[model samples]
Target chain A: MLCYRAWVETRWRFLICLTVMLLPSVLYFHELGIFPMQHWTSDPHYAYGLLFGTHLPSIGIWTFAAVFLGLGGLLRERAVGTSTLTLTLPVSRAHVVGTRVGVGASETVALALAPWIVNSSISLFERTPFSRAQAGWCVLLLVGGGLVYFACAVLVSSVVEGEYTAAALMFALVYGIGYLADHVSGFSALNLYPLMSGTRYLDRNTNLFPGPMPWLGILASSSASALMLLAAVTITRRRDF
Target chain B: MIAAPAIQTSSLSKYYGRTSAVQNLDLVVEANRITGFLGRNGAGKSTTIKMLLGLIRPTGGDGTILGRQITNPELNRQARAHIAYVAEDKPLYRYLTVAQTVRFAAAFYRDWRCDVAGKLLREYELPLNRRVKALSKGMRTKLALLLALARKPELLILDEPTEGLDPVMIEHLMQTIVARAAEGTAVFFSSHQIAEVERVADQVCILDRGCLVLDRSLDSLRESFRRVDMVFPVDVVEREFQLPGVERIRANRRQMSVLTSANAEGVIERARAFNAVSLEVAPVGLRDVFLAMVNGLESAIGKEN
Candidate 1:
């Protein structure tokens, strides 16, 4: 029932994010030639373009959508004057927070998977089909490496009070991290953007990930996400409102 | 075996740094009774309610509802299963229709009464298809209240339930409160409506500046509180009638008014000794008692009336 409430509150945002990611995927897939997003060259690198592919544009959009999904809960409920109705329900605060995170994370997973799922289904019908293993690996990389942003969002919203403030603060925080990772010179192995897009493991000659998937990078981001969510739970469990 | 008090607290206090919200508040509301919680604005009535429901953690002390510890999350959650609360603002999801709102609330509690839900829908004239945000303030208030009244909880708490209600709705709500109590729900409500509290409450607790200054049964308050008006030939000072039970004294020329929580007979005896030409004694109404109690602390509070 709580899941229903959570879903009802978030379904629109989830659907909007899904559509944003899904529409571009189909556009990029069926376009006359790859790399048509920018300028087309005489000798097209189809495999290389598909490697970075539709998932590249969606990474940034999904990150923001994930953040928006995590931007509401009891603290935001306080701003909206519904904290009493929510908190007084015959359920634990942990249960409330858990249900929201569960729904949001599930939606995040679906958004991450939707584009690739459709593209992979389309690939099966093409004259020259793409590797399903590569798409599966891409999804695994996206979910495992990108969930920290969503969790970071949950933490930010839990700690902050208003929607716009939490959103602004989350953007600034993520932007700052991205800037530091880019400029700091030595943090590339742990760089979340590279991890999320699978750029670090990709090969230009054939396709991305000539070796194996970046399992360690996934582990690192997933751990950070877990820690942030844990902190959020603790803060919310003891918060006055 | 004895049933626990529906609500109990031991020095339950809430403090925001230097400022205090509820100070050393030891409150005990008996089971199967309606206790009207009265307080001036910022008297910590809502803060205390929030603490009791675990919406906020207490800064100090501890309390319980239905014998479950309020500070313990699991116990508080269990206690809420049998507690129905309507907040002062009467909040509801703007996106849901009245029927969806009812359905949302029903999903949380097993003891939800559909009969009362239907009856209130008819009585309050709430349109099931209307979204909460689209409803008028009065209608939304009714819907927020209906969600709680529909539940057959062991304890029912409402903060300032009649604040924005019209006279007709106020009368209906008062009756519902009484009816809920009659059905064995221990109801603790805060209201600025002294008349409504007088009509429905078995126990009246008045909070002043984060302190529980008054807690008494309605019968006892009616029996004991008195105001004695006296006329004296000689000039009299305010201190002339500082009797033990005398709570406040207002004097003007030869006329002296004395308010007492108890010992009205003693005040009358003292008034006679002062050689008063005429004396009139009247039982103090709840309004008068509230005024005298708050007035004793600050003259400005009485001016707000």
Candidate 2:
């Protein structure tokens, strides 16, 4: 019930942002007639594919959502003083942190999925010849990215006292990694920068031309996310509420 | 007499760097009694409550709630199952409505009394749909109290539960706490308001500067401590004035008030030798006892120095 209430309060803002995010992609597709020219030979089709492919990494976007959503969970409670309510309950600290993380992960998933569902529905009307396999991969990347971001956000919220500071740190880490990945080659592994680069991967579909599945990138993102969540739970448990 | 206290502390202490918040304090709260934990601000009342609830660790010594050792996680967890707490700040989720907040709290406790909670909300005239952030301070305190009371736990620890509440709300809270105590729930709460303590408390524990100054049943405290007001014929110099059983003495040229922990008659007899013109013995309440004990402790220290 706590999780559901939190989701209801936050879902509207999330959807609004998601809608605004899809606008640029929709306009780009319409202006270039990417839908009408399905043939690989046409510039629009290739351009559209490249655009979607470049944004395929999902790691960065998911990370940003993770952090953003995690902040909402941890910091909101602290802000409202509801954290005391949770602490006084006859439950363990682990249960409290776990429930919050689960709720956050679920919200991130819904947020990530909403965009894919909306884009897919719109594509049906536009007659865009986008690959279903690519769409599925995009969703996977989003989930993975969301998990990593959620973990990082939770970790930051646990350690930082104020909500704004936690949010700023999350933004810096997410975009900082993305900026580094764009300028430096080997550093692309750190590009799980939550917001800017995760969606950018889906925008360009860079995953299709990638060598070796970017296993190193996937591992780094997932490991960082898991480690952060673990740290958050541990810290919360030991804290004096 | 052999049964363990509902709440017990042995040499419990908390230190924040060089400063000690509560130092080597020992206290025991027996079952089926409302213990009024009284202290001035920064006197370690909140710190002591926090340590008792295991919200914070004690730097030294240990405590037990419902017979479980403070450090035993499993025991603490089990012991907490029988306890409920209302924080001093009355903090709740601001975004959630009152009903939603209650529902959220209900999820954690197995023995939560929803009927009681509903009754409290209605009786307290609290709006169910109002978000916690929108509620007034008194309303928030009521809701926090309602949540704690609805659990019907064996022990309830409240930290300054009535601090910001208006008179009527404070009275209602006292009634509710008294009612809860009647049902055999051990109530341990801290407040600076002496009148409230005098009204409902069965036992009173007075703390000053992280030390336990007075711990006695309210009735016994009143019975044992006496306030003797005396008017003297002449001025009494500091060192020359000595009275039997007088723990503390405050005197002016023509008037003197002596606080005697024992032998009030003996003190009065000694006061007669000083050519006292008038003498009156008044029954002491928690406030008088508190002032007397605190002042006496200070004076005793001063004399030693």
Which portions of model 1 show Cα errors greater than 4 Å? A32-52, A185-190, B252-254, B297-305
Worst 10 residues of 2 chain A by lDDT: A205-214
* Cα lDDT tens digits for candidate 1, A156-236: 999998847888999898888888788887865546777778876777665646767778878888999999998998999
| Candidate 1 colliding pairs | A202-A208
lDDT, residue A117, candidate 1: 76
Clashes per candidate (backbone, < 3 Å): 1, 32
lDDT of 2 by residue, B127-152 (tens): 99999889988888888888888888
Model 1, residue B143: distance off in Å is 0.8
Report lDDT per candidate.
0.85, 0.73
Tens-digit lDDT track of model 2 for A1-241: 6556656656765665455555545654564464344553344345446445434433444445556668854444666566666666676777767877787787677765665565566556565545555655555666664577678778888888764888888788777776888898899655544332344344343333232234456666678888988898888767765
What TM-score fits each model? 0.93, 0.84
